[model samples]
Structures are given as C-alpha cells and as structure tokens.
Target: MEDIGYGLLDRAMIHQITERWRHGGIGIIVLQLRHVNAASLEAVQLWESQQTRLFWRYRMENDYFFFLNRMKSDRQMKLILDSAITSLKKGLQAAAAESSVDERAKPPFTIGTASASPSGLGRSAETMIYHALRDATLSMLRLRMKEDETELPFGSGQAGARSEWSSSVGIGILAKAIPTFDLHAQVSSLAKLFESNTHVQGAVIVNQGRPVGLVMKEKMHQMLAGQFGLPLYWNRSVEKIMDDDSLVVDASIPVEQVAQLAMARDISRLYDVVTITRNGKLLGAASIRSILECITNLRTEEARTANPLTGLPGNAAIQREMKQRIESRQPFAVIYADLDYFKWYNDCFGFAQGDALIRYTAAVLQDVTGILGGRGDFIGHIGGDDFIILTGSSAEDADKLCRNMIWRFDGGIKSFYNGEDVAHVVDRSGNRIEQNGVSVSLSLVYCDGSEDITTEHISQAAARLKKQAKQLNGSVHVMGEVFEKHLGEGRV
Candidate 1:
C-alpha cells in the first residue's frame, strides 16, 4: 500500500502488464470507479485492506482498479461482487449512522461492476479494458434504473453487432502524454528533453494535479528562435511560452465523434493535437496525424460497404439499421423496393439507361425518406434496382411514401423514352413487356418492436412482401399484414 507503484503506472508499463496478463489468459475482476479523488482513493484502499487474501492489483488513469479473478464460472464472479455490494451498503449505512463523522465529507465510490478475460492474443489488453469499462457503465445505469438482473451486462463477453466499435479502446493516443510541473524549471532542461526523445511533441504542465497549460514543440521552438529569447527566458517558467488554448477531450468519446469534434475547431486550432482525459485527468494526446489517419480508415470502411452504382449503403448498413430499430423498440417500418421488369428494360435500353433508372430510384428513395420519414429515416441500396428504407412505422406515412415514389418515377419515366414512344404510349418493345414504363414496387413490413426480432426476420418478411407487390398490375405498395390475410401464412 505504501509503494509508489500504486496509481503510478505510465501507459507503457500499463500496456506491458496488460500484455502479460492477456497472454497468460488471466481473467480480471475490476472495480470501476465513477470518479478518482482523495475520498475515492481512501474508499478503494479501505475496501482493498479488508480483503486479506488478494490477487495482483492494477489501476488505470486512477479510475479503474483491476485484480485477477480466478473464478471458474460467472455464478462465482456474481457471488464475489454480490458480497462486496452488501458490504458496501452496510458501510454506507454505518457512515450515515455515525453522527460524530463530518456531515459534508462523503466517501468517493465505485459504481456497478463488470469483468473480462481476454482470450485470443488478437485482442489487445486496452480493448478488453474498454469493453469491461463499458460494461460497468451500463451496469451502473441499470442499477440506477432499479432493474433486476438475471445475468451480467454486455452478456458477459458476448459480442453483438455494435459491440465491436462500442468495446474498442481509444486510438493509439493514451500512451503519448508525459507530465511536466515546476514551471520555473530551466528551458535548457526542456530543450534537452526535446532533444532526447524525438517522439515527444508536447508535454502537459500540471501543478498540484491540475492541468494549467500545454507546452508544444512548435510554440517552444518559435519562442527560442527569436533574438535573445532563449537567454532571456532560459530560466523562466514554461507557462509563459505554453499554449493556454489547448485542445482537450474526454477519453470515452468514440473515434467517429472525436473526428467530428476535433475537426470543428477554429482554423487556427484545427491542427492542434487533442488532449484525452478520463474523469478530468490527463490521459494523453492524439496527434493531428493520428486523427486524420483514423478518419481515413473510417471513410474507407464506409466506402467498402457502399453500393458501386447508387453509392448508397449496402446490406451491412441496412441490416445494422434494422437491428438498431429493433433494439430501440421504436415503431418503424422496413421498406423493400424493387424495380419491376427492370431486367427486360435493361436488355432493351442497354446498360446506360438501366444505370440511369437505378440512380433515379436511389434519389427518389432518399427524397421520400427525407421528406416524409422521421428524423432517423434512411435509404440504402442492396445492389441492382433493389433498395431498403427505414422510417416511422405509421401506416399513413408508409402509404404516402409508396405513392410519392411511384408518382415521381412515373412522372420522370417519359423523358427516358424516345419521342415516338411518348407519342405511342407503348412502343413495340413496351407492348411485349408485361409491366408498364419501368414501374417501381415497394413492399412494407411493420414491426411494433414488442417481440424479439432479428435482422434475418426483417429481411425475410420484406422479401415476401416485395414478391406480392410485384404480382400486381402496376407499381404499388403491399403491406405484409394485409398480404398475410390474403394469401395466408404459407405465401405471406
């Protein structure tokens, strides 16, 4: 307890320990603190001191206290935390009952708990910690809501669709911060530090554990380059030269959001490295280079999953939207739209007109969804003339969307036809075609979201509904419920 090592592990040392534990296949039971302060430190220590038998201890950003848990089953892990939970309640009661204790000073505390054991070496220790921290945060939320639990949060290492991004630790940013204090320290020493470690772009200055300013290399070099400046300010406080307008962000923010925030700064501060913190304590800085690289990778992933022609999101995005809608239990409708008799039209008009028709459909879907659907409504292409739209589950809204899309396409269809085709209303090619003028078919599936649902269920239901609508005379919308009644369950 008296060792300087407690709460003092730098990022490198932390990573080293994590790699070791991860490679060794050890499971960690971490007591996650909502905040880290003197009161919280005392509470953690008091709790730690009471547990006579122990496992190796670890701390990160002074917010997460980790120890190895050798339990063979989740039930055993639950028992351990349940016992600690009881003791924590009793301690709070005792503290409240004691009138002699100071009334204003309440002990700092950890909230609900979560644990993880990194299995494959492919999973970095930092990522595991992040997932566990997210689990703890959710556990705390559920506890506050007074929800009774049958199993652990995050399904105890279960990986769902969104979990991959949700569980990731920050980018290569946390290990880059090095603290500096004693603003009066000689500039020669600062120069030596800059010279010694070529990688150190900046240092955060703190006094009594509070971030005061930031000293960046470019600013420092500019000051030193001035005539007589080095000699004049060599022995002075770096605070005089430090950039007071430092970029700071919470470490818990997702990379995508971080990119948006980091880019939203003023032109002058746009390229400044971001300072990442946890519970208001400095964790590290992510360089402008790192942020740009991260953004590029995100864009690349988006492009990879997008449709080649329509450029709308492909199946992955569509499925994800369905899953999210189901999870939120919002009254929403899933629309499957297909271009009826598009193949015959493509063969007649050649690929160029076929491509234009698809693009037109994409635009129509986007416009209708944006104009008629609620805030989160979206349109995604599933290749060819097939697409999907998610919108408010209102039956009226669905009807309007279907009607509007058909009208738009039909209104514009004449332009693609030759002048004589417009005069004749049906060319020789059109007469042979069963469908009229490149009609668009839309099928609607309504989900109340009360029942448990999966992406596959939504897709299958939409496909069946789409087939029913195609069998109609012209471009039309078919509701799955009505179709089910008309054809029975076998066809619906």
Candidate 2:
C-alpha cells in the first residue's frame, strides 16, 4: 500500500497501481475533499487513513483521492461511501466543537462522490481516473451552489451536449454519453430508463473509463419479452447481457472512417451505437442513425465539390488547399497532369474505355504521389483527365516525381491500344493519328511561397505550361524556362 498512506504515490506508483487494479477487475470510487489544500500532504494522508480501510486510497490530483475496491453493485458502493462520509463528518464535527465558536459555524469536510466498476469500463486507467476526477469537480460545484437537493450524477455523462456542424465534420460532433451504466445494473432498471428516456436507444456500460459493453434498448427488451425472461435474468449483471464486441472508435477519427467501420458491422449490429474514445478513454457514444445522417450530408457536400470519377478532391477542395498553403507561406509545387491524345483516344476507344483509362491514370498518379509525397503533399482531381499534385518537395523532386509517373504510366497503358494503334495506323474513324499511342503530358508549376498565388492563377499558369508539353514529343514534362515566363521566375 506504499507505506499505507504515510508516503505519497508518485506518477510511477499511480500508473502501476491503476494498471494492476484495472486488470484485476476492481472498481474505483472518488471523493472530492474540499479542504485538501488547506493542510499539508501528510495531514491529508493522515486524515484519509482515518476514514476507511476497505480500499487502498491514492491521490490523483488536487483535492481528489480515489480508492480501489472489489467490483460491487452501485448500491453497495454507495453504502460503503456513506459510512466513510459519516466517519469524516464525525471527525470534523469533533474538531469544530473543540475549536472556538467561530470554527463551529463552518465544517472542514465536504465530499463529492462517484463510483464505477471494472465490469463496465475496461482497463483504461486514464478514462476511469478522468471520470472520477470530473465527478469530484461536479460534486464540489454542486455543493458550492447549495444544490444539496439536486441529484448528483454518477454514471455515463451529461444527457445533452450541443453539436457542431462543418464540412468534413468529425465523429466528435455527434458523440453522446446519454446513458451509461455499470455491469451490475439490473434489467428492470434499464427497462424503466429506456421507457422514460425515449430519446436514448442504448446505454454504454464501462469499467473504470474503458468500455466493456453496449446495451441497445430494443435488443434488451426483445430478449426480455421472451418466455419467462424477466424472472430469469432481471437481476443479472450487464456483462452477460451487453454487446461485448461493440464497435468502438477514437473520437478524433474523421466521420468518413467512422462510417466505414459502422457499416462493416453485421446487419443486426449495423445500427448499433459507436462508442468514441479519446486516447483510449471513453469520451462519448455516437449512434449509426446520427452517423448516417452526417454521412449523407457529407456525400451531398462531396457531390457538389468532389470529383465524381476518382472521388478525389475537386476544384473547390483544391482551391481551399491552395488557399491554405499560400496562407502558410510554405514553398509548395503543383504538378498539372493531362492525357495527351485523350480526345482521339475517347473518339476511337469509345467513352466507356476512355473512363477506364482516366481511372487508370488516377490510380497511377495516386500511387506515385503516395510514394513521393511528403507529409503535406496532396493529390486532387481537377476534373476530366486532368489532375493536380501538391507537394512540399522542391522543384527538382517534383520534376523527378512527374518523370516517374509518366514513365510508369506509358509502360502500364500498353493494354489500352491494339496492334494498329501501336503501329501508328488509322483509327476506326479513318483518322490517321501520330505514333503517340495515347501518351500523357505534365506541366510542373512552382510557387516559392513568396507569391500569393490563387488557384485560378495556378490553373492558368499550368495551362500555359501544358501547351509546352503538347509541343514536345510523346509523354513529356515541362518545368524549365518555357513555363517560368508565366510565373515571372525560373523554377530550379
């Protein structure tokens, strides 16, 4: 017990004990002692030892010392806490009586209490400790506000939280902690909860701060309405009844990934609530209903702004990207790619095959950029067979990337043409084409971060450079003085 409260628990001891406690399936009860800072650490520790021996206590932070005990029902935990609170009150009362009349008017002790068992929240020490600390703060707040008659909340989180809406809205925007429970929570109590709170569809059961299970109201009721179900399982722990393998996600993850994870669940569990966490600690829960609605909104936004073919960011997104890069004052290069002889290829090979070629080109560009791109590099489709690559790489590196892309694509697109096209023969339309055999052209554009180049300015600059590529031989890139005249500076 680390000298049995005489010696303090440092960061190392706290981590060690918290982890072991979590793995051992223990519960945590936090108390917010309002007068902790008034006395020395030794004095506070001495006071705490006099309070209880049922659990080993550890000081988490200012004014908070949580105890680890065996996982028990909340009712039992409350009873234990009640006794501890009585002991603390008695000591304070005796002290006050011993002091002068002025000291009797004010008590030295007030506690904010909350408990969570290991069967609900898992082995996440950070999450459990956070909730315990938050509860203590809430308790102190309630006491100071003279809210003694107000019910002190102990589980899950606040019922309602305001939401935010933006483009590329994250899962955090819709995350909720509406209903949370412990493992020992009864079926009858849960049923009543669901009945009264019609808005909430499920509850997240946590141990400490880690999620152990999720209980959807519909599924629980469905199970209970069966033959003699209520009598058979009314008093059982939620661990046996909850969805142990529920979908959990990091809260910072984008909604795009969240939606994919949610949809990948089985058909029966597809609409289940997705629990969101922050650094492995339970933050809130999001429903599939809310996620889908947010996704629908995203799709609408993407449809209006994203490339329909490759699903890459389009002009609107690209423009925003350029604006941000320019504002950051960082040197970035933009590579504009266009398919040479694509007009004739579309005419000869038909639009269906033409789209196949475009998709193929997009894949090749993505592959190349992904390999060469720095942390800030971005790939965007500028509509049709034209695309853009933004990179923090220098002009030389951008030139190397474009050369590799063109070489790989020219070799890979051999299947796009038949013998006649490869032999520089006439097409089905009887149009004699050059021996170009459907090659690509690239125009590399650079902004040294000194110029405030807009997306329009970039598009125009690249278009001018693309003309130079069209003038060159099959599958060529232009990055020299030819395009530099447009930028008013030569690219190195």
Error of 2 at 71 (Å): 18
- As a whole number from 0 to 100, the lDDT of residue 266 in candidate 2 is 54
- Which digits, one per residue and each the tens of the lDDT, describe model 2 over residues 1-492? 334431123344356446544654333333433334423344445556664333455543334454645433334656666776666556655554454445332334446666544556354665555455445534653453232212222111211110111222458888787578877777777888999998778898888878888998877876787688788778877777899999988775668678777765653575578999887878899876467557545544544455556656677767766776777687888888888777777877899989889888988887887787675577778788998887889987988898889878987888887545464534456767566577788888888878666777777878888877776657878774223554322221
Q: Who wins the TM-score comparison?
A: 1
- Candidate 1 at residue 468, lDDT? 74
* Overall lDDT per candidate, in order of appearance: 0.59, 0.64
Error of 1 at 100 (Å): 78
- TM agreement with the true structure for every prediction: 0.46, 0.42
Worst 10 residues of 1 by lDDT: 154-163
Query: Per-residue alpha-carbon lDDT of model 1 for 185-244, expressed as tens digits?
Result: 666678778878887767777655556677766557666867887888777777677767
Alpha carbon deviation, residue 133, candidate 2 (Å): 21
